[model samples]
Target: MRPEKIAEANEIDARVAGALYMILADYNGMDMPTTNELKKSLRENGASFNVVKNRMLNRALSEDASALLKGQTAMIYGDGDVVEVAKVIKKFTAAKKKPVIKGGFVEGKSISAEDVVELSKLPSKDVLRAMLLGTLQAPCSQLVGVMNQKVASLVYVLSAVIDKKEQEA
Candidate 1:
């Protein structure tokens, strides 16, 4: 490859390094159409996958990107819906008898295949977000109930006072 071509490849690889790191960091490897299929599915689902050259990918993963490239930085590729990426990889692996997870960088740490399995077990971002919303709303709902009860008690007291005054008159 010419020096310029090599540089360009390296640039692309570097640009995708974060993505690759995310993939390998979250998954192992896939079989033929399964891999391609998964990649396609991810793209359709608002994510992406890439089969990048190791040399270029490695070049992109310099020490600066190490935090996100911690463990197996050499082979990694994917971007979008960080959690969804992992979930799709997980789903494909589960469906295919032999699609194994490799490794990946998560939040600047390198993780193993087993670690990726654990990642797969996690609920998606939306699920977590919903859980958070429910958690927040629970207390607010309880507060509203408590406030309404207090207002009802005041109303009852006033009603009783009016009833007694009318009887006395």
Candidate 2:
């Protein structure tokens, strides 16, 4: 490759490396339309899919990133939710299993292909956040309920006492 082309490729790789997470996969036998559709879907979900030269990716990323470059390697990268990206990849791969996730990096740590699958199984960020909010609010909600019952009981007891006094009079 010419120097200018190499520089442009390096720039692209650098941007991909800056993503929050990356999924390395094999895209050996996928048709162009399928590949384009996958790329489109990924882009819509905030991930950019690229068929990169292994050498270029290695140069742009860490030494460990090179481990996943054995087969026809492609990268899915973005600053969006990693789990969401993994879920998209998981769904796409389920339909056509060519671009199997090999491995990738998340938060600067390398993760195995199995890790990516497990990540896909996890709920999305919003769902997880809502679950946490529910959990945190549970105790507060119970406390409010108990306090309301206490106030109601006090009111009932005071009303009964007043009625008894009236009867005595």
Candidate 3:
């Protein structure tokens, strides 16, 4: 390969390295239109997909990440929520049954295709935050309710005592 071409490939690899997740997929036997559609879908969701030579990809990725690359491979990388990107890919694969995921990594940890699919099924960060907030607030809410009930009971008892004293007088 020419020096300039290698430089360009290295640049692309470096760009992908900054993303939160890197997915390696096999696009073998997939039609051009389908692949283009997948690329467009990924692009719409803040991801870029490129067909990468396995050798070049292997060279670009870390040792652990590179182990996931083999055969005909394409790369998907995005700075957005990795789970959301995984969801998009999962949905696309379910519909098209092409571009099978070989493996991937997130934040330097290798993950299998099944792991990616499971990640896709996870709730978004916001939803998870909401759930945690609700859990944390539950006890406090209950504590307030208990305090209110005790005050109401004390008021009731005092009112009864005052009514009895008035009747005696």
- Candidate 3: tens digits of C-alpha lDDT, residues 80-143: 8887788889999999998899888788778898998898999977888999999999999999
TM-score of 1: 0.71
Each model's lDDT comes to 0.62, 0.88, 0.85
- Per TM-score, what order, best first? 2, 3, 1
lDDT per residue, candidate 2, 90-130, as tens digits?
99999988688999988878899999999999999999999
How far out, in Å, is residue 9 in model 1? Answer: 3.0
Model 3, residue 161: C-alpha shift (Å): 3.2
- The candidate with the higher lDDT, 1 or 3, is 3
Worst 10 residues of 2 by lDDT: 58-67
Better of 1 and 2 by lDDT: 2
Candidate 2 global CA lDDT score: 0.88
Ranking by lDDT: 2, 3, 1
